[model samples]
Target chain A: MAQQVIIKVDNLVKKFGNFTANDNLTFEVFKGEIFGFLGANGAGKTTALRILCGLSSPTSGQVEVAGFDVYKQTNKIKMNIGYMSQKFSLYEDLTVRENIRFFAGIYGLSRKIIRERTDELLNKLNIEELGDKLISSLPLGWKQKLSFSIAIFHRPQIVFLDEPTGGVDPITRRQFWDMIYDASNDGITVFVTTHYMDEAEYCNRVSIMVDGRIEALDTPETLKKTYNAKNMNEVFLMLARK
Target chain B: MDNPAISIENIIKSYDKVVALDDISFEVDKGELFGLIGPDGAGKTSLFRILTTLLIQDSGNAIVEGFNVVKDYKKLRTIIGYMPGRFSLYPDLTVEENLRFFATIFNTTIEDNYDLIKTIYRQIEPFKKRLAGNLSGGMKQKLALSCALIHKPEVLFLDEPTTGVDAVSRKEFWEMLKELQKKDITILVSTPYMDEASMCDRVALIQNGRILEVETPEEIVKLYPHSLWAVISSDMYKLESDLQSFEKSVSVYRFGDSIHLSVKDDDIYGSDIKEYLESKNQNKIKVEKIDANIEDCFMALMNNNDL
Candidate 1:
């Protein structure tokens, strides 16, 4: 049995002026795998993520997302992937139901499908009563959970989550990871970036970026054993310090 | 007894209908590294604001360096340094300009207090001419700390200083904080990172504007009342759901490669869990009784509070 590679990047280089933001990165994300993108601040994680999300083009290299070429099929790539960041997830003024409907519509879902999915999503989250309430009024944890649900609402082949659980409670954070696992179980490839080391350990495999380069990419257990470190935090400190 | 660096006596703060801080009280001794750990909307920022004299509490009182927060706010301001959760430095100003501006406002020259911020300032010296807004996240944080320390206050308050910072930079920032504490400056820092709590001499685990426990990290970890077990199997997700359905499971949380399960009964052995999961056809199951860390203690406290 062969694993399906949903995102393929080979010698990917992204430069901004003279600075190489992503330097010769190569990695493949398989279907239904939770890929953890770990990096220090200013380590090109954002640049690579932007490139993968089709918001920016790569400087050089072969890149494919959802079977679409990065250079020529950016729109198709965007259509096939979902993105949610902690900074921008949902419209604050819009009601929960409205935010869901708007994003579903943007994803080109039909009116009938959007209507049905909205109810299903609200009920699944057990927030059916709060559907009419504005997103701004919801708690941070609730908003974050709802944002994640909406991000995968269109059923994109891959969902990019950027620090999706930042500043949430421990229980809520674990619940959020459980949701990620559920998404992976449902066959959506999860590509995420987080500063929390524990969250990094939750990934099926993790790639640590250093100075705009992929310094290490492997399962957390292997990485920990290879580095002789107790946990991902020590592994990160060891690699990042170097 | 000698005067504690900072003291809060039943400090209560609210806005309209929202109670930001509910009779919060704590004390930090002089030259101690104290951490206020909690999630966002935990009223950390509100408490910081009140102590820094930026906002007034609706009731109760706070004292910093023996100066009343309300009555002697002016005096308190002159002796305390505050780095807000958000970047409050002038974004348009150059790094050097911002540091110098902060120095001037404190009735001191850059040269007069250069030694106080020497270590932090030296790192940002190359970027002295760069606009504060243009610096990277890590560099911006370094610059902010430099500016905060330019006045060399006896007490420092850092609100979520490492919130969005990466692991490497966060380690470096804590090193800087440790360096600062050596100078006999009382430091009060807040962060959502549970791992960082161990670095502090003592920590106050706060949630919902109320303090859950204030003790050394070791003491806090010792407070976890349940025996924890780490369980892993072929199916990670199913392992979590299955553990949740277990009759004796009190709480089941996904922790990295394994599920940390707390049984309702303490005497439940690892073999018992293994047998149950094996019955469910979970392969390669590994179960071990493990000690709790700060995060586990925090989760237990949070759950108990909810109940």
Candidate 2:
């Protein structure tokens, strides 16, 4: 059961000069679980994600991903985890197939595996016909879906998605979560941050951060019951009010 | 003088042979809060742009408040307020400065009509000195609303005004719109959030540049056309897959923690669906007949439009 705790944090603190972005945050993500990190805009959700993904440093406390210290094992963590950001973090000038080739190349996938997986992902996403189209031409939803697929192309143990469906419609959002479900089914842990309350209900467990502190964390059902609310939005409102 | 607020007869718009609006025709009732409800690229923006005299239609005619959109573009501009999907406030200017600039552009001032925006402006009054770019998303949204209302135009056009905004802010924004509606300013707003459909006086469900149905929110929800159910069960993936496999599943759409299922016929009983899930080893299966909401009506209209 020791392997179940794929990620653990204790009193994790991150500060940028005088501002403490993340304060004494503690949480644990289980194996094969979809974890949701939620908060308002500028609520320090992004700050905590940056620390976990090794994009920045924490001023104090401890963080361990896949049982490795984030400070000492940053490179190993990068190799073992995938991170999809809020922005479309791909080359807009490149073609669909070329974008996949570039990222898979960096992860050092074998040529045969890259070619096979790239084709499979494109087909599954129903964007095979637009494989030659520039990333700039595709709609917002398609760009987000492709960015997510590219993030996890290397088969990382833990994949973090930061507001993966920010401006997309509900139907496109359903499609994006379907891919996320597919990933988690393959034993990959999904850690996603979103401001959308309905999307928050999609997670196996959720933690709400407010004012640089984690205010609530539990399964969606439990959180709803505990807060005496009907949905995640009400629950967030309840906690934010406090 | 033409008396209608806006008029369009079989207006078609295309970009390089790609049809965006196809023979779409609609009219804005005087002093009516009209809503164009659909997802992204559903021609909501295109329609608003056309009605506001920004883009000319290809084959038909459209007029705003009796001014031909194609012929009297300048006359239409002074009478219609437009708030785009993205915030268009000058980022370099402060909240008050931005409001002042827009008012001046329309040949008015904050002192001229401060009462029109008093409700919304009070919320942002403390931040009047802060640049528009430095404000929060919700604050920027309020500022935009105030600037648009500063001129007190006859018609207001908002394209997905609530997108990217928090729930509280969205609720607040709609309240402000409703308050403004009492003053008889015809409001035409477009949004992708199906839940927001109920807030409007009358809504036109548009998809693929075509109007599916037009009705009041209550009337639309009342005419849901079929019975719906909200099913909650364990092993959600298995339950979802099983529901999809079931022949009775019209459309198993997810709504929060429950999967909302619709049936082809209105008379189908809910107990049968509950029992079917029970036989599939799905625990905690609870399927009860529920009332159809605006979202349900919108989906039904969309599905019907497909046919």
Best candidate (score: DockQ)? 1
B1-307 per-residue lDDT for model 1 (tens digits) = 7889998999988888788899998899999999999999899999999999999999998999999999999999999999998998999999989998999999988899888888888988998999999998888888888888888899999999999889888988999999999998999999999989999999999998899899999888876777789998988868888998889988898776678998766888999999999988899999999988888888988887321
| lDDT of each residue in A1-242, candidate 2, tens digit only | 56499899999998888988898999999988999988766678878888888777788998999778889888888888988875657889998889999998988899999999988998887778988999877776788889999999999999999777765666677878989999999999999987678888999999988889999999999999998999998998777644
lDDT per residue (tens digit) for residues A103-212 in model 1: 99998999999999888988888878999999988889999999999999999999999999889999999889878989999999999999999889899899999999
Off by over 4 Å in 1: B305-307
Highest-lDDT candidate: 1
Which pairs of residues have clashing backbones in candidate 1? none
Q: Provide per-model DockQ scores.
A: 0.80, 0.47
Model 1's CAPRI class is: medium
Worst 10 residues of 2 chain B by lDDT: B298-307
Please state the error at residue B239 of candidate 2 in Å: 0.7
**What lDDT does each candidate get?**
0.91, 0.85
**Candidate 1 clash figure, as a count:** 0
Model 2 TM-score relative to the real fold: 0.92
List pairs with backbone clashes in candidate 2.
Answer: B5-B65
Which candidate achieves the best TM-score against the true structure? 1
